[model samples]
Target chain A: MSFRGAVVTFPGSNCDRDMAVALEAVSGVPAIRVWHGDAELPADLDFIALPGGFSYGDYLRSGAMAARSPVMQSVIEAARRGVPVLGVCNGFQVLTEAGLLPGALMRNASQHFICRNVKLKVENSQSLFTAGYSAGQILSIPVAHHDGNYFADDATLDRLEGEGRVAFRYAETVNGSARDIAGVLNEAGNVLGMMPHPERAIEDALGSSDGRALFESAIRSLVEA
Target chain B: MKVRIHVSLKPGVLDPQGRAIHHALEGLGFEGVNDVRAGREIELDVDDSVSDEALDAMCKQLLANMVIENYRIERVAA
Candidate 1:
Protein backbone atom coordinates (compact mmCIF):
# COMPACT_ATOMS: atom_id res chain seq x y z
CA MET A 1 0.00 0.00 0.00
CA SER A 2 1.19 3.47 -0.78
CA PHE A 3 1.93 5.73 2.14
CA ARG A 4 -0.95 8.18 2.50
CA GLY A 5 -0.40 11.47 4.34
CA ALA A 6 -2.28 14.69 4.93
CA VAL A 7 -0.90 18.18 5.55
CA VAL A 8 -3.11 20.63 7.41
CA THR A 9 -3.19 24.26 6.35
CA PHE A 10 -4.47 27.18 8.35
CA PRO A 11 -5.04 30.68 7.03
CA GLY A 12 -1.57 31.94 7.90
CA SER A 13 0.30 28.75 7.16
CA ASN A 14 3.23 29.45 4.84
CA CYS A 15 5.05 26.10 4.89
CA ASP A 16 2.17 23.83 3.94
CA ARG A 17 3.41 23.52 0.36
CA ASP A 18 6.95 22.75 1.50
CA MET A 19 5.69 19.98 3.73
CA ALA A 20 3.57 18.56 0.93
CA VAL A 21 6.48 18.61 -1.47
CA ALA A 22 8.77 16.94 1.01
CA LEU A 23 6.25 14.26 1.85
CA GLU A 24 5.54 13.57 -1.80
CA ALA A 25 9.20 13.48 -2.75
CA VAL A 26 10.18 11.11 0.03
CA SER A 27 7.19 8.77 0.09
CA GLY A 28 6.32 8.96 -3.60
CA VAL A 29 2.83 9.71 -2.35
CA PRO A 30 1.22 13.05 -2.78
CA ALA A 31 -0.09 14.48 0.46
CA ILE A 32 -3.69 15.66 0.63
CA ARG A 33 -4.07 19.27 1.65
CA VAL A 34 -6.71 19.83 4.30
CA TRP A 35 -7.93 23.17 5.57
CA HIS A 36 -8.21 24.10 9.21
CA GLY A 37 -11.97 24.53 8.92
CA ASP A 38 -12.54 21.09 7.43
CA ALA A 39 -14.46 18.96 9.86
CA GLU A 40 -12.88 15.68 8.84
CA LEU A 41 -9.74 14.36 7.19
CA PRO A 42 -9.40 12.06 4.22
CA ALA A 43 -9.92 8.50 5.34
CA ASP A 44 -7.14 5.91 5.63
CA LEU A 45 -4.39 8.41 6.27
CA ASP A 46 -1.15 6.74 7.38
CA PHE A 47 0.40 9.98 8.56
CA ILE A 48 -0.62 13.55 9.37
CA ALA A 49 1.61 16.62 9.29
CA LEU A 50 1.11 20.07 10.76
CA PRO A 51 3.60 22.31 9.02
CA GLY A 52 5.31 25.38 10.44
CA GLY A 53 3.87 28.86 9.87
CA PHE A 54 2.32 31.74 11.77
CA SER A 55 -1.08 30.13 12.21
CA TYR A 56 -3.81 32.66 13.11
CA GLY A 57 -1.09 35.28 12.92
CA ASP A 58 0.21 34.03 16.24
CA TYR A 59 -2.66 35.88 17.87
CA LEU A 60 -3.25 35.79 21.62
CA ARG A 61 -0.40 33.33 21.90
CA SER A 62 1.51 31.39 19.34
CA GLY A 63 -0.62 28.40 18.38
CA ALA A 64 -3.09 29.20 21.14
CA MET A 65 -5.87 30.08 18.70
CA ALA A 66 -4.99 27.43 16.16
CA ALA A 67 -5.15 24.69 18.72
CA ARG A 68 -8.86 25.31 19.22
CA SER A 69 -9.62 25.30 15.51
CA PRO A 70 -12.33 23.06 14.11
CA VAL A 71 -10.09 20.62 12.28
CA MET A 72 -7.79 20.01 15.25
CA GLN A 73 -10.60 18.04 16.91
CA SER A 74 -10.48 15.53 14.10
CA VAL A 75 -6.70 15.57 14.15
CA ILE A 76 -6.77 14.88 17.86
CA GLU A 77 -9.07 11.93 17.29
CA ALA A 78 -6.91 10.58 14.50
CA ALA A 79 -3.84 10.89 16.71
CA ARG A 80 -5.55 8.93 19.45
CA ARG A 81 -6.30 6.16 16.95
CA GLY A 82 -2.55 5.65 16.43
CA VAL A 83 -1.99 7.51 13.16
CA PRO A 84 1.48 9.03 13.09
CA VAL A 85 1.47 12.83 13.45
CA LEU A 86 4.43 15.12 12.89
CA GLY A 87 4.22 18.74 14.08
CA VAL A 88 7.03 21.08 13.15
CA CYS A 89 7.84 24.57 14.54
CA ASN A 90 4.54 26.42 14.76
CA GLY A 91 2.96 23.04 14.50
CA PHE A 92 4.87 22.05 17.62
CA GLN A 93 3.44 25.08 19.37
CA VAL A 94 -0.05 24.03 18.30
CA LEU A 95 0.46 20.54 19.69
CA THR A 96 1.53 21.84 23.09
CA GLU A 97 -1.35 24.29 23.20
CA ALA A 98 -3.77 21.54 22.20
CA GLY A 99 -2.51 19.43 25.10
CA LEU A 100 -1.44 16.72 22.69
CA LEU A 101 2.05 17.21 24.10
CA PRO A 102 3.48 18.53 27.35
CA GLY A 103 5.04 21.92 28.07
CA ALA A 104 4.70 25.24 26.25
CA LEU A 105 6.94 27.04 23.78
CA MET A 106 7.96 30.35 25.30
CA ARG A 107 9.77 33.41 23.98
CA ASN A 108 13.49 32.80 23.48
CA ALA A 109 15.62 33.66 26.49
CA SER A 110 17.81 35.81 24.24
CA GLN A 111 14.70 37.79 23.21
CA HIS A 112 15.71 37.49 19.58
CA PHE A 113 14.18 35.63 16.69
CA ILE A 114 16.69 32.88 15.87
CA CYS A 115 17.04 31.45 12.41
CA ARG A 116 19.93 29.17 11.51
CA ASN A 117 21.15 25.63 11.01
CA VAL A 118 21.53 24.00 14.41
CA LYS A 119 22.98 20.63 15.35
CA LEU A 120 20.62 18.18 16.99
CA LYS A 121 21.34 14.76 18.37
CA VAL A 122 18.81 12.03 17.78
CA GLU A 123 18.04 10.78 21.24
CA ASN A 124 15.37 8.11 20.70
CA SER A 125 15.83 6.58 17.29
CA GLN A 126 13.13 3.97 17.88
CA SER A 127 10.19 6.26 17.12
CA LEU A 128 8.56 6.22 13.69
CA PHE A 129 9.99 9.64 12.91
CA THR A 130 13.59 9.12 14.06
CA ALA A 131 14.03 5.43 13.27
CA GLY A 132 16.14 6.31 10.22
CA TYR A 133 18.81 7.96 12.38
CA SER A 134 21.30 6.27 14.59
CA ALA A 135 21.08 6.86 18.31
CA GLY A 136 23.17 9.83 19.44
CA GLN A 137 23.86 10.77 15.83
CA ILE A 138 23.92 14.50 15.18
CA LEU A 139 22.16 16.17 12.24
CA SER A 140 21.98 19.79 11.16
CA ILE A 141 18.44 21.07 10.81
CA PRO A 142 17.26 24.63 10.31
CA VAL A 143 15.36 26.27 13.17
CA ALA A 144 13.58 29.61 12.80
CA HIS A 145 11.27 30.83 15.46
CA HIS A 146 10.83 33.46 18.17
CA ASP A 147 9.01 31.26 20.70
CA GLY A 148 11.02 28.06 20.46
CA ASN A 149 12.04 27.84 24.07
CA TYR A 150 10.26 24.78 25.49
CA PHE A 151 9.22 24.91 29.13
CA ALA A 152 7.72 22.31 31.48
CA ASP A 153 7.73 21.59 35.19
CA ASP A 154 10.50 19.60 36.81
CA ALA A 155 8.45 16.44 37.35
CA THR A 156 7.07 16.44 33.84
CA LEU A 157 10.52 17.00 32.40
CA ASP A 158 11.94 14.19 34.50
CA ARG A 159 9.15 11.84 33.45
CA LEU A 160 9.55 12.63 29.76
CA GLU A 161 13.31 12.04 29.95
CA GLY A 162 12.92 8.88 32.01
CA GLU A 163 10.43 7.40 29.60
CA GLY A 164 12.76 8.03 26.65
CA ARG A 165 10.20 10.30 25.07
CA VAL A 166 12.76 12.92 24.11
CA ALA A 167 13.38 12.32 20.44
CA PHE A 168 15.91 15.07 19.73
CA ARG A 169 18.23 17.27 21.76
CA TYR A 170 20.03 20.44 20.70
CA ALA A 171 23.78 19.86 20.60
CA GLU A 172 24.35 23.52 21.52
CA THR A 173 22.36 26.13 23.38
CA VAL A 174 20.25 27.11 20.42
CA ASN A 175 17.34 28.11 22.64
CA GLY A 176 16.73 27.90 26.35
CA SER A 177 14.54 24.84 25.92
CA ALA A 178 14.48 22.88 29.14
CA ARG A 179 17.10 20.14 29.11
CA ASP A 180 17.91 21.25 25.56
CA ILE A 181 14.94 19.29 24.25
CA ALA A 182 14.46 19.94 20.56
CA GLY A 183 11.85 17.29 19.83
CA VAL A 184 9.58 14.97 21.76
CA LEU A 185 7.43 11.88 21.22
CA ASN A 186 4.13 11.14 22.83
CA GLU A 187 3.83 8.21 25.20
CA ALA A 188 2.77 5.94 22.33
CA GLY A 189 5.59 7.26 20.15
CA ASN A 190 3.06 7.92 17.42
CA VAL A 191 3.03 11.71 17.77
CA LEU A 192 6.19 13.73 17.30
CA GLY A 193 6.65 17.51 17.69
CA MET A 194 9.74 19.55 17.09
CA MET A 195 10.77 23.17 16.62
CA PRO A 196 13.05 22.67 13.60
CA HIS A 197 11.96 22.70 9.96
CA PRO A 198 12.77 19.21 8.75
CA GLU A 199 10.70 19.68 5.62
CA ARG A 200 12.91 22.60 4.59
CA ALA A 201 16.04 20.45 4.87
CA ILE A 202 14.82 17.43 2.88
CA GLU A 203 16.45 18.34 -0.43
CA ASP A 204 20.16 18.60 -1.23
CA ALA A 205 19.43 21.77 -3.19
CA LEU A 206 18.19 23.20 0.08
CA GLY A 207 21.74 22.72 1.35
CA SER A 208 20.95 19.65 3.42
CA SER A 209 19.84 16.05 3.00
CA ASP A 210 19.67 15.38 6.72
CA GLY A 211 15.88 15.71 6.86
CA ARG A 212 15.33 13.25 4.03
CA ALA A 213 15.99 10.37 6.38
CA LEU A 214 13.15 11.51 8.64
CA PHE A 215 10.59 11.41 5.82
CA GLU A 216 12.07 8.18 4.52
CA SER A 217 11.84 6.67 7.97
CA ALA A 218 8.15 7.50 8.25
CA ILE A 219 7.37 6.10 4.83
CA ARG A 220 9.48 3.04 5.48
CA SER A 221 7.77 2.37 8.79
CA LEU A 222 4.33 2.76 7.27
CA VAL A 223 5.16 0.34 4.47
CA GLU A 224 6.80 -2.18 6.76
CA ALA A 225 4.05 -2.04 9.33
CA MET B 1 -22.60 40.29 34.52
CA LYS B 2 -19.08 41.43 33.76
CA VAL B 3 -16.02 39.33 34.47
CA ARG B 4 -12.42 40.36 34.21
CA ILE B 5 -9.80 37.70 33.87
CA HIS B 6 -6.18 38.39 34.63
CA VAL B 7 -3.82 35.93 33.05
CA SER B 8 -0.19 36.02 33.95
CA LEU B 9 2.88 33.88 33.54
CA LYS B 10 3.72 32.32 36.84
CA PRO B 11 6.60 33.72 38.82
CA GLY B 12 9.99 32.30 37.72
CA VAL B 13 8.69 31.59 34.24
CA LEU B 14 11.00 33.42 31.89
CA ASP B 15 9.34 36.51 30.39
CA PRO B 16 11.59 37.84 27.66
CA GLN B 17 9.17 40.52 26.51
CA GLY B 18 8.77 41.75 30.05
CA ARG B 19 12.53 41.77 30.57
CA ALA B 20 13.06 43.73 27.40
CA ILE B 21 10.69 46.41 28.61
CA HIS B 22 12.51 46.47 31.93
CA HIS B 23 15.83 46.98 30.19
CA ALA B 24 14.41 49.86 28.15
CA LEU B 25 13.29 51.55 31.33
CA GLU B 26 16.69 51.12 32.96
CA GLY B 27 18.37 52.48 29.86
CA LEU B 28 16.25 55.64 30.19
CA GLY B 29 17.77 56.19 33.65
CA PHE B 30 14.63 55.23 35.55
CA GLU B 31 15.55 54.03 39.04
CA GLY B 32 13.90 51.77 41.66
CA VAL B 33 12.20 49.60 39.02
CA ASN B 34 12.66 46.34 40.85
CA ASP B 35 10.91 43.96 38.42
CA VAL B 36 8.55 43.78 35.51
CA ARG B 37 6.39 40.98 34.13
CA ALA B 38 3.83 41.08 31.39
CA GLY B 39 0.26 39.77 31.59
CA ARG B 40 -3.10 39.91 29.83
CA GLU B 41 -6.54 41.09 30.82
CA ILE B 42 -9.69 39.59 29.31
CA GLU B 43 -13.06 41.17 29.81
CA LEU B 44 -16.13 39.04 29.42
CA ASP B 45 -19.77 40.03 29.19
CA VAL B 46 -21.91 37.09 30.15
CA ASP B 47 -25.50 36.49 31.16
CA ASP B 48 -26.23 36.96 34.78
CA SER B 49 -27.33 33.34 35.02
CA VAL B 50 -24.04 31.99 33.73
CA SER B 51 -22.65 29.83 36.45
CA ASP B 52 -19.17 29.83 37.88
CA GLU B 53 -18.55 26.41 36.37
CA ALA B 54 -18.98 27.76 32.86
CA LEU B 55 -16.59 30.63 33.54
CA ASP B 56 -14.03 28.24 34.96
CA ALA B 57 -14.41 26.02 31.94
CA MET B 58 -13.88 29.00 29.66
CA CYS B 59 -10.60 29.82 31.37
CA LYS B 60 -9.40 26.23 31.51
CA GLN B 61 -10.29 25.54 27.91
CA LEU B 62 -9.10 28.68 26.19
CA LEU B 63 -8.50 31.95 27.99
CA ALA B 64 -5.53 30.69 29.96
CA ASN B 65 -3.08 27.93 29.10
CA MET B 66 -2.74 26.36 32.51
CA VAL B 67 0.61 24.83 31.59
CA ILE B 68 2.63 28.02 32.16
CA GLU B 69 0.11 30.71 33.07
CA ASN B 70 -2.27 31.32 35.94
CA TYR B 71 -5.67 33.03 35.67
CA ARG B 72 -7.72 34.88 38.21
CA ILE B 73 -11.34 35.86 37.62
CA GLU B 74 -12.86 39.00 39.15
CA ARG B 75 -16.50 39.95 39.16
CA VAL B 76 -16.92 43.53 38.06
CA ALA B 77 -20.00 45.58 38.89
CA ALA B 78 -21.89 46.46 35.78
Candidate 2:
Protein backbone atom coordinates (compact mmCIF):
# COMPACT_ATOMS: atom_id res chain seq x y z
CA MET A 1 0.00 0.00 0.00
CA SER A 2 1.16 3.52 -0.77
CA PHE A 3 1.88 6.00 2.03
CA ARG A 4 -0.94 8.45 2.75
CA GLY A 5 -0.33 11.85 4.29
CA ALA A 6 -2.19 15.10 4.93
CA VAL A 7 -1.03 18.71 5.34
CA VAL A 8 -3.23 21.08 7.29
CA THR A 9 -3.32 24.69 6.15
CA PHE A 10 -4.47 27.44 8.44
CA PRO A 11 -5.63 30.76 6.98
CA GLY A 12 -2.23 32.47 7.12
CA SER A 13 -0.20 29.33 6.57
CA ASN A 14 2.61 30.12 4.12
CA CYS A 15 4.50 26.81 4.16
CA ASP A 16 1.63 24.39 3.63
CA ARG A 17 2.57 23.84 0.01
CA ASP A 18 6.17 23.20 0.93
CA MET A 19 5.04 20.62 3.43
CA ALA A 20 2.78 18.97 0.86
CA VAL A 21 5.51 18.81 -1.77
CA ALA A 22 8.02 17.43 0.69
CA LEU A 23 5.66 14.69 1.85
CA GLU A 24 4.70 13.77 -1.69
CA ALA A 25 8.30 13.63 -2.79
CA VAL A 26 9.44 11.53 0.13
CA SER A 27 6.45 9.24 0.64
CA GLY A 28 5.62 8.81 -3.07
CA VAL A 29 1.98 9.66 -2.33
CA PRO A 30 0.00 12.82 -2.76
CA ALA A 31 -0.79 14.51 0.52
CA ILE A 32 -4.36 15.58 1.11
CA ARG A 33 -4.86 19.30 1.74
CA VAL A 34 -6.79 19.93 4.94
CA TRP A 35 -8.15 23.36 5.75
CA HIS A 36 -8.43 24.78 9.22
CA GLY A 37 -12.16 25.33 8.89
CA ASP A 38 -12.94 21.75 7.93
CA ALA A 39 -14.50 19.71 10.66
CA GLU A 40 -12.89 16.45 9.67
CA LEU A 41 -9.77 14.93 8.15
CA PRO A 42 -9.36 12.51 5.25
CA ALA A 43 -9.81 8.88 6.23
CA ASP A 44 -6.95 6.45 6.79
CA LEU A 45 -4.23 9.05 6.80
CA ASP A 46 -0.80 7.70 7.71
CA PHE A 47 0.67 11.07 8.61
CA ILE A 48 -0.55 14.58 9.36
CA ALA A 49 1.67 17.68 9.10
CA LEU A 50 0.97 21.12 10.49
CA PRO A 51 3.07 23.42 8.39
CA GLY A 52 4.80 26.66 9.41
CA GLY A 53 3.11 30.06 9.04
CA PHE A 54 1.48 32.87 10.93
CA SER A 55 -1.87 31.21 11.53
CA TYR A 56 -4.56 33.71 12.54
CA GLY A 57 -1.96 36.46 12.17
CA ASP A 58 -0.36 35.29 15.38
CA TYR A 59 -3.13 37.10 17.25
CA LEU A 60 -3.56 36.97 21.01
CA ARG A 61 -0.69 34.50 20.96
CA SER A 62 0.99 32.45 18.31
CA GLY A 63 -1.16 29.48 17.31
CA ALA A 64 -3.76 30.35 19.97
CA MET A 65 -6.63 30.92 17.55
CA ALA A 66 -5.66 28.15 15.16
CA ALA A 67 -5.43 25.65 17.97
CA ARG A 68 -9.07 26.34 18.81
CA SER A 69 -10.21 26.13 15.20
CA PRO A 70 -12.56 23.38 14.00
CA VAL A 71 -10.03 21.19 12.17
CA MET A 72 -7.66 20.86 15.11
CA GLN A 73 -10.32 18.81 16.91
CA SER A 74 -10.05 16.05 14.36
CA VAL A 75 -6.29 16.44 14.15
CA ILE A 76 -6.01 15.93 17.88
CA GLU A 77 -8.33 12.94 17.74
CA ALA A 78 -6.45 11.40 14.84
CA ALA A 79 -3.14 11.93 16.62
CA ARG A 80 -4.48 10.18 19.72
CA ARG A 81 -5.35 7.14 17.63
CA GLY A 82 -1.65 6.51 16.88
CA VAL A 83 -1.50 8.29 13.52
CA PRO A 84 1.76 10.18 13.14
CA VAL A 85 1.47 13.94 13.61
CA LEU A 86 4.32 16.35 12.88
CA GLY A 87 3.97 20.00 13.91
CA VAL A 88 6.53 22.45 12.55
CA CYS A 89 7.10 26.05 13.72
CA ASN A 90 3.66 27.58 14.27
CA GLY A 91 2.26 24.08 14.14
CA PHE A 92 4.38 23.29 17.16
CA GLN A 93 2.70 26.15 18.97
CA VAL A 94 -0.72 24.84 17.95
CA LEU A 95 -0.08 21.32 19.24
CA THR A 96 1.06 22.72 22.55
CA GLU A 97 -2.00 24.96 22.81
CA ALA A 98 -4.28 22.08 21.78
CA GLY A 99 -2.78 19.94 24.57
CA LEU A 100 -1.42 17.28 22.22
CA LEU A 101 2.07 18.34 23.33
CA PRO A 102 3.52 19.98 26.40
CA GLY A 103 5.00 23.47 27.00
CA ALA A 104 4.45 26.82 25.29
CA LEU A 105 6.31 28.77 22.60
CA MET A 106 6.97 32.25 23.88
CA ARG A 107 8.59 35.15 22.04
CA ASN A 108 12.27 34.81 21.24
CA ALA A 109 14.45 36.20 23.95
CA SER A 110 16.02 38.45 21.37
CA GLN A 111 12.50 39.68 20.67
CA HIS A 112 13.06 39.28 16.96
CA PHE A 113 11.98 36.93 14.21
CA ILE A 114 14.94 34.68 13.45
CA CYS A 115 15.29 32.90 10.12
CA ARG A 116 18.34 30.72 9.53
CA ASN A 117 19.67 27.21 9.24
CA VAL A 118 20.71 25.86 12.64
CA LYS A 119 22.31 22.64 13.77
CA LEU A 120 20.24 20.21 15.81
CA LYS A 121 21.25 17.13 17.73
CA VAL A 122 19.15 14.02 17.28
CA GLU A 123 18.31 13.49 20.90
CA ASN A 124 16.07 10.48 20.42
CA SER A 125 15.97 8.36 17.26
CA GLN A 126 13.59 5.76 18.66
CA SER A 127 10.40 7.59 17.73
CA LEU A 128 8.84 7.40 14.30
CA PHE A 129 9.82 11.00 13.61
CA THR A 130 13.59 10.56 14.00
CA ALA A 131 14.36 6.91 13.25
CA GLY A 132 16.23 7.87 10.07
CA TYR A 133 18.77 9.72 12.22
CA SER A 134 20.94 8.03 14.74
CA ALA A 135 21.18 9.28 18.29
CA GLY A 136 23.77 12.08 18.59
CA GLN A 137 23.75 12.78 14.86
CA ILE A 138 23.72 16.43 13.82
CA LEU A 139 21.46 17.90 11.18
CA SER A 140 20.89 21.42 9.92
CA ILE A 141 17.28 22.62 9.68
CA PRO A 142 15.82 26.02 8.95
CA VAL A 143 14.05 27.84 11.78
CA ALA A 144 12.01 30.95 11.16
CA HIS A 145 9.65 32.21 13.80
CA HIS A 146 9.15 34.98 16.34
CA ASP A 147 7.47 32.89 19.00
CA GLY A 148 9.64 29.79 19.22
CA ASN A 149 10.95 29.99 22.74
CA TYR A 150 9.98 26.76 24.47
CA PHE A 151 8.85 27.03 28.08
CA ALA A 152 7.71 24.46 30.63
CA ASP A 153 8.01 23.96 34.34
CA ASP A 154 11.28 22.49 35.58
CA ALA A 155 9.54 19.36 36.86
CA THR A 156 7.89 18.77 33.50
CA LEU A 157 11.23 19.42 31.80
CA ASP A 158 12.88 16.83 34.00
CA ARG A 159 10.13 14.33 33.22
CA LEU A 160 10.36 14.92 29.47
CA GLU A 161 14.11 14.40 29.59
CA GLY A 162 13.97 11.35 31.85
CA GLU A 163 11.37 9.69 29.61
CA GLY A 164 13.41 10.22 26.41
CA ARG A 165 10.62 12.30 24.84
CA VAL A 166 13.02 15.05 23.69
CA ALA A 167 13.44 14.21 20.03
CA PHE A 168 15.81 17.07 19.13
CA ARG A 169 17.85 19.79 20.79
CA TYR A 170 19.57 22.81 19.33
CA ALA A 171 23.31 22.27 19.03
CA GLU A 172 23.71 26.01 19.56
CA THR A 173 20.84 27.79 21.24
CA VAL A 174 19.09 30.17 18.86
CA ASN A 175 15.75 31.08 20.43
CA GLY A 176 16.49 30.99 24.15
CA SER A 177 14.40 27.86 24.60
CA ALA A 178 14.62 26.20 27.97
CA ARG A 179 17.51 23.74 27.88
CA ASP A 180 17.84 24.26 24.12
CA ILE A 181 14.93 21.91 23.40
CA ALA A 182 14.34 22.05 19.68
CA GLY A 183 11.74 19.30 19.36
CA VAL A 184 9.74 16.90 21.48
CA LEU A 185 7.48 13.83 21.26
CA ASN A 186 4.17 13.09 22.87
CA GLU A 187 3.72 10.41 25.49
CA ALA A 188 2.80 7.80 22.89
CA GLY A 189 5.76 8.91 20.72
CA ASN A 190 3.48 9.37 17.65
CA VAL A 191 3.13 13.14 17.85
CA LEU A 192 6.20 15.30 17.21
CA GLY A 193 6.42 19.07 17.62
CA MET A 194 9.42 21.12 16.57
CA MET A 195 10.28 24.73 15.80
CA PRO A 196 12.65 24.07 12.88
CA HIS A 197 11.25 23.85 9.35
CA PRO A 198 12.44 20.48 8.11
CA GLU A 199 10.16 20.74 5.09
CA ARG A 200 12.26 23.64 3.84
CA ALA A 201 15.45 21.57 4.01
CA ILE A 202 14.37 18.29 2.41
CA GLU A 203 15.98 18.95 -0.99
CA ASP A 204 19.64 19.78 -1.60
CA ALA A 205 18.58 22.68 -3.80
CA LEU A 206 17.08 24.14 -0.63
CA GLY A 207 20.57 23.83 0.88
CA SER A 208 20.19 20.67 2.99
CA SER A 209 18.87 17.11 2.80
CA ASP A 210 18.85 16.60 6.54
CA GLY A 211 15.08 17.13 6.63
CA ARG A 212 14.40 14.26 4.19
CA ALA A 213 15.49 11.92 6.94
CA LEU A 214 12.47 12.90 9.05
CA PHE A 215 9.90 12.20 6.34
CA GLU A 216 11.76 9.06 5.27
CA SER A 217 11.91 7.76 8.82
CA ALA A 218 8.21 8.28 9.29
CA ILE A 219 7.32 6.61 6.02
CA ARG A 220 9.54 3.67 6.82
CA SER A 221 7.88 3.20 10.19
CA LEU A 222 4.41 3.38 8.65
CA VAL A 223 5.27 0.84 5.95
CA GLU A 224 6.97 -1.55 8.34
CA ALA A 225 4.19 -1.38 10.87
CA MET B 1 -22.48 40.64 33.54
CA LYS B 2 -19.20 42.06 32.38
CA VAL B 3 -16.21 39.81 33.00
CA ARG B 4 -12.63 41.05 33.06
CA ILE B 5 -9.90 38.49 32.78
CA HIS B 6 -6.32 39.33 33.58
CA VAL B 7 -3.77 37.11 31.94
CA SER B 8 -0.20 37.57 33.10
CA LEU B 9 2.92 35.56 32.56
CA LYS B 10 3.88 33.42 35.52
CA PRO B 11 6.63 34.65 37.80
CA GLY B 12 10.16 33.78 36.68
CA VAL B 13 9.00 33.24 33.10
CA LEU B 14 10.97 35.38 30.66
CA ASP B 15 8.94 38.16 29.07
CA PRO B 16 10.81 39.38 26.01
CA GLN B 17 8.16 41.88 24.99
CA GLY B 18 8.08 43.32 28.46
CA ARG B 19 11.83 43.61 28.40
CA ALA B 20 11.74 45.41 25.08
CA ILE B 21 9.22 47.86 26.40
CA HIS B 22 11.37 48.44 29.43
CA HIS B 23 14.36 49.12 27.26
CA ALA B 24 12.40 51.60 25.19
CA LEU B 25 11.26 53.35 28.34
CA GLU B 26 14.83 53.68 29.59
CA GLY B 27 15.93 55.03 26.23
CA LEU B 28 13.31 57.76 26.64
CA GLY B 29 15.14 58.97 29.82
CA PHE B 30 12.81 57.32 32.32
CA GLU B 31 14.65 56.33 35.47
CA GLY B 32 13.92 54.21 38.56
CA VAL B 33 11.64 51.87 36.66
CA ASN B 34 12.65 48.60 38.21
CA ASP B 35 10.87 46.34 35.71
CA VAL B 36 7.88 46.02 33.47
CA ARG B 37 5.92 42.83 33.00
CA ALA B 38 3.22 42.99 30.41
CA GLY B 39 -0.10 41.13 30.58
CA ARG B 40 -3.42 40.92 28.77
CA GLU B 41 -6.81 42.04 30.00
CA ILE B 42 -9.89 40.62 28.29
CA GLU B 43 -13.34 42.05 28.73
CA LEU B 44 -16.34 39.85 28.04
CA ASP B 45 -19.94 41.03 28.16
CA VAL B 46 -21.88 37.86 28.83
CA ASP B 47 -25.36 37.18 30.06
CA ASP B 48 -26.06 37.06 33.77
CA SER B 49 -27.20 33.48 33.40
CA VAL B 50 -23.66 32.30 32.70
CA SER B 51 -22.54 30.27 35.69
CA ASP B 52 -19.33 30.99 37.56
CA GLU B 53 -18.08 27.50 36.86
CA ALA B 54 -18.46 27.98 33.12
CA LEU B 55 -16.66 31.32 33.25
CA ASP B 56 -13.83 29.80 35.23
CA ALA B 57 -13.64 26.97 32.73
CA MET B 58 -13.35 29.47 29.92
CA CYS B 59 -10.37 31.14 31.55
CA LYS B 60 -8.68 27.86 32.36
CA GLN B 61 -9.29 26.27 28.98
CA LEU B 62 -8.93 29.06 26.44
CA LEU B 63 -8.66 32.62 27.69
CA ALA B 64 -5.36 31.87 29.36
CA ASN B 65 -2.60 29.38 28.67
CA MET B 66 -1.70 27.92 32.04
CA VAL B 67 1.68 26.65 30.90
CA ILE B 68 3.52 29.93 31.49
CA GLU B 69 0.73 32.26 32.47
CA ASN B 70 -1.81 32.77 35.22
CA TYR B 71 -5.33 34.13 34.92
CA ARG B 72 -7.64 35.91 37.34
CA ILE B 73 -11.31 36.60 36.75
CA GLU B 74 -13.16 39.72 37.90
CA ARG B 75 -16.90 39.85 37.62
CA VAL B 76 -18.84 43.12 37.50
CA ALA B 77 -22.27 43.23 39.09
CA ALA B 78 -25.04 42.45 36.64
Q: Best-fitting candidate, measured by DockQ?
A: 1
Pick out the ten consecutive residues of candidate 2 chain A with the lowest summed lDDT. Answer: A23-32
Task: List where candidate 2 sits over 4 angstroms from the true fold.
Answer: none
After best superposition, candidate 2 residue A12: deviation in angstroms? 0.8
Span of 10 residues, lowest total lDDT, candidate 1 chain B: B10-19
> Please, what is the whole-model Cα lDDT of each candidate in the order they appear?
0.93, 0.94
For candidate 1 chain A, which ten residues in a row score worst on lDDT? A203-212
Candidate 2 structure quality by residue, lDDT tens digits, B16-73: 9999999999999999999999999999999989988998999888889999999998
Superposed by TM-score, candidate 2 places the C-alpha of residue A197 at a distance from the truth, in angstroms, of 0.6
For all candidates, state DockQ relative to the true structure.
Answer: 0.89, 0.88
Chain B TM-score of every predicted model = 0.93, 0.93
